[model samples]
Target chain A: MSVVSLRGVTKRYGDTRAVDDVSFDLHENRIHGLLGRNGAGKSTAMRMLTGQEVPTSGQVRVFGENPYENADVLSRVCFIKESQRYPDIFVARHALEAAAMVFPNWDQDFADRLVEEFRLPLKSRVRKLSRGQLSSVGVIIGLAARAPVTLFDEPYLGLDAVARQAFYDHLIADYAEHPRTIVLSTHLIDEVADIIEHVTVIDRGRIVMDDSSENLRSQAVTVSGPTKAVEQFSDGHEVLHREDLGGFTRVLVSGVPTGRDTASLQVEPVSLQQLVVRTTQFHDAALAGSGNGNGKGNGKGAWS
Target chain B: MDDARPLFQQIAEQIEDSIIDGSLPEESRAPSTNELAAFHRINPATAANGINQLVADGLLYKKRGVGMFVPAGAREKLVERRQEAFGRSYIAPLLAEARRLEMDAEDVKKMIDAWRDDQ
Candidate 1:
């Protein structure tokens, strides 16, 4: 069942609609990847969902109730962002203590273990920690809080490769034992592609793609061959992208028929990252072609 | 693991490979969904989906409160299924590449004989 649902949610700031008419559902006990480019309104949608920001229009519901100022719903939700702030005089340990008090499902032992694993300096002032160290503080709290609905926004900022791997490993291990609804918003699609069961791609101020990861995986393919052969293979399919090199042509097409004669063409599956990028570009090109005319016509040139 | 197919499909293939190689013998317990998820560092639901695929295919059976087990003759059955798919999965691509290089079936047969001699 969907634990968090947004219906036609629109968060506007001044003249800008940060999240425009967005609607999606977050199912219970599933990991969701909320992905997009920078300033795609991911953060704004997340803020509205966590009750930190109110939508100018539409509704945001958590556990079937409005999350705004609702302590019961808010308590079950944990929102971890890269820009999380703490008091000036507070130390690292103080943050954990505060989280432990606020979250009913907090596990001090798990937090302590994470503190050691991340090599966090508990006694150091919050402002004194390194960038990676600060991110670790948030990661630890998010993990140990064990909230029923947790949203992580760019939680790996400044974390090294090894540290990020440790975070993923810990997340998978802990989540296998304790399942909960998780929304991970990050630009590192390849890293979290396997861990996320569902994918939601937001662009500008709207959702461009939302589906299970498995369905998205097989939704598109890249066919490369001689120009005529590639064009024939891509016939009647939704071509998200196309590239030409002399006589060779390559196209990323969706809804390709199975068991077709691919003897003369090179067919390869499009990666999740590639699919998101192409889909966003395709959407942008459509918008430009339809006279939205922002004059940012970079993606439009590729179509012709 | 690769982007060529779904992760769960790859997970099922990995387990099938193990069973076919006799490493995961018939009648032996299969890895739990949690164990597979942790080992592969994937979502538990994806791992569960992979296990369910095997269950649906009758390659693995649940023992009700115990765990999944590879049924008797699962290895032979898997081997036969894989062999049936070998031509499309392996030879089709091989022939396509050969055709691109302007090689006929006779040339491919000669190359195969040479490769066998080298092995």
Candidate 2:
């Protein structure tokens, strides 16, 4: 079932169109990675999806209905953002209490355990909490709430590697027990590549790529070897990227080709991060070459 | 043992400890990915990386679409493999360094004896 659907969604700000005619359907019971570079209209699209911001044109359907100002839709959707504002007087526990009241499926026991695990000072004011602790608070609520549709917009921005790993662990564990539609929007693609089931790449306020993570990883290969040998092997292949390192050359090719003599070449699948970078690079070049310096890469619908 | 070993290596050691302590017997189902991830609040990718290492070492196996379970004789296999790795990756390096530092084999033998006696 489609948990969310967007049809010709366009968001404009004066002369700049943020999201332009982006159409897609997010299925239920899967984790989706909302990937994009800075100012890709990801946050804007998310705001529209959660009903925080209205679209200039097009329709957004959450569970087959409009989510804007809809109490039923709002309650079922949890948007955990990088900057979550709470009352100045609200303490760490107070925030948890507020979250508990908002989420019908809130588990107090799990929240208590998470608070202790994160070592958050419950008595400290929300504003006084460290950036890591603040992020932790949001993560704890997001996981414990177990909302059917959870959107996390760079929730671990300021967290260190260890703390980030902890969040990933908690998310995986909680998610295994309770599977839901999760949209994780962040630049840390390689970090969470394994857990994201579906992926959506947005660039210039448009959806460029949307597919299963498994297929994305398996479809692209990084071929590297001697410069001449690599070039020869990459012939007739869709090269997403190419770089020369002295006598050696590396190319990220789309889809592995069979019947290719690769015994002398080093061929391996591209990592999720590499794939994203190469894809964005390819888009940038195509944009520059089209003489539409002002164009947002074909004005959306770039994902083919 | 280096105190600052990688997190995944540390996790692997912890799982080994559970086997040594009889907490997780051979052929038992290991903790699910979610259990490890949620309990550690780790990125599921990192936790999976650690578990994949264990799986590579024959300590764990997946049951098709089901969760991972401990392989038969996994405890014994891990114990043997880890003992070999310790000798090569740690003990050999320590002995080599000790030799370079002018510590005699007899001295090393004496130190080992003393450590064992103390234990």
Which candidate should be chosen as best, given DockQ against the real structure? 1
User: Per-residue lDDT for B12-73 in model 1, tens only?
Assistant: 98999999999999999999999999899899999998999999999999999999999998
Once fitted onto the true fold, the runs of candidate 1 whose alpha carbons sit more than 4 angstroms away are: A258-260, A293-304, B91-118
TM-score of chain B of 1: 0.95
lDDT of 2 at A109: 94
Top candidate (TM-score): 1
Residue-wise C-alpha lDDT for candidate 1, range A99-127, written one tens digit per residue: 99999999999999999999999999999
Top candidate by lDDT: 1
Reference-based TM-score, model 2: 0.73
Instruction: Give a tens-digit lDDT track for model 2, residues A78-105.
Output: 9999989999989999999999999998
Residue A66 in model 1: shift from native, Å? 0.5
TM-score of each: 0.93, 0.73
Q: Cα deviation in Å at residue A274, candidate 1?
A: 0.8
RMSD per candidate (Å) reads: 2.7, 9.6
